[model samples]
Target: MANRIHPTAVIGDGVELGDNNDIGPYAVIVGPTVIGSDNWIGPHCVIGTPASDRGAPHPAAWHDAPVGDPEQDGFGVRIGDGNRIREFFSVHQGTKRPTTIGSNGYFLRSAHVAHDCRIGDGVTLGSNVVVGGHSEVWSLANLGLGVVVHQHSRIGPGAMVGMGAAVTREVPPFTISRGVPARVTGMNVVGLSRRGVSPEAIAELEPYVIQGAGELPELPAELAKLLTEWAREGHRGEH
Candidate 1:
């Protein structure tokens, strides 16, 4: 099927769009961007703009960034298939690399994805959710309405942040967090169950969530691996 792009929509030069996309009226997609199939880009959405790095000494400083194009430097957004980007959503490009959104994302109205973010598959960013620069949201994570994530933090796979939470640190996989500073409240048992994770596996991982736990209990192989990786990444201060 052919792509349905509205005449009022502005698709810039060098933009690559795959089949069956529906670009809404007045949606502005700028160049060096690649969008995959079956995306619903809603009205007034702006994509592939330059990163908002105003702290750089000079305007031309972004030109010399390590990654991205020298000529069209800082102007690239890569979006995968089957995304529903609602009205007024905006996504900026990277300073060094492309800001990437994985497949099957549901970005609600006025959701903002800032520069260099790596959003994984099946992610849901609720209305007015704002993700700061360079943050990584893992697969199947859900950010509730008006949630704000700080720069360089990681939201783990299957994690859920409650409404209006201010996330300042890394959220562990399959955890539920809420509050101004976003403290880990409990395991994401419901989320894991919905994903078909066994009850035993959930039980095994529960001990890890206890505060001040110096040692991890013996867990399933997959859970153990995930915990190890999470610890390593947390140690690197990626939050």
Candidate 2:
């Protein structure tokens, strides 16, 4: 049940890592960070660093330990279990609250998750994807390579963003959004199919996202729960 931390990896104070974590060489993990089990943290990943927010303190830049004070660590970062964070990935600490990452995420090389973001489970952030502060990428979303999500935006569940797009607006669930300022080109039928959503359900759900209005179809329980919350918040016509 012991963690496999490389000799060169710097595990600073206040870090709480769970069992069976494979932390690669030169990966610096500072705390207040609570990383769950079965994570493969690749080399040179800098996690739990102070926020780049102009207002947050910058003690981590010069201090031997990134999070010099446990309380002044620019807020906390909590990453869930079964994640594969590739080399050169950086997740900054939150400016107001904890930057939370749910279980089973795959962050590719050089992806940057900025402060106060909430990344849901089964999300795939492709290489060099930059998610701005306070953003929420809902479960099962796929952000392609070099996609830049605007600050405070939300990428809804099962959405697919094309490579190298600048996402300035919200992306609705199960849609294929592309282009600068990203618009919904079509439904993500492929992704929906992969998720085992039936043709009947996909048909029923199409109007909800397309028109960006109305009640949700009787989707699968998991889909229903997530989208219902999204709908209840009146996220219509903002996509």
Candidate 3:
């Protein structure tokens, strides 16, 4: 199927789009940004703008528009398939590398992903959520409304962050985090159970979430991979 792009939308140069995308009115997708299939980009959403740094250059995104220099265009954004990006969301261009968003994501209104952020598959970011630059939100993680993730932080796979929390540090996998400076309060048992994780495995992962230092109990291959990554990243200031 063909893409449905509103005439009022601005698709700048070097922007590549796959099939079946729905781009709404007044949305701006600038150059160097690559978007995959089946994406719903809502009104007023912006993607692949310049990095947030004050000194960064704004490269020309349009085709031969002669507005800005394309030679200095540092890096752009790469978005995967089946994403539902709601109104007023913004994804900034990367400073060092491409700011990447994985497949099957749902970002609510007024959310923001700063430069160099990495978002994994099946993630849901609620309204007004903001993630600082270089942060990573792993697969299946759910962030509630108005959650603010600090720079260089990681929210591990299947983690759940409650609304209005300010995450100053990393969040471990399969955990529930909330409050001002978010800390792991409990396991994400509901999420785990919904994903069909066995009770034994969920119980075993509890210590890993709580203590943040221990041998991981036997889990499914994917869960094990996520845990290993969490360990390697080292729950930086999880408390």
- How many backbone collisions does model 2 have? 0
Q: What would the per-residue lDDT of candidate 1 be over residues 1-239, giving only the tens digit for each residue?
A: 89999999988765789999999999988756799999999999988766787774223222232334634664468999999999999998777678999999999999999988999889999999999999999878999999999999889877899999999978877789999999888889887776566787677666554342445555546555656766676532212
- Over 4 Å off, model 2: 61-74
Superposing all C-alpha atoms, what RMSD in Å does each candidate have to the true structure?
4.7, 2.3, 2.7
Model 3, span 23-81: residue lDDT tens: 99999998678899999999999998877898877665654432333346446789999
Clashing pairs in 1: none
The 10-residue segment with the lowest total lDDT in model 2: 61-70
In candidate 3, list every pair of residues with a backbone clash.
Answer: 13-61
lDDT of 2 at 192: 83
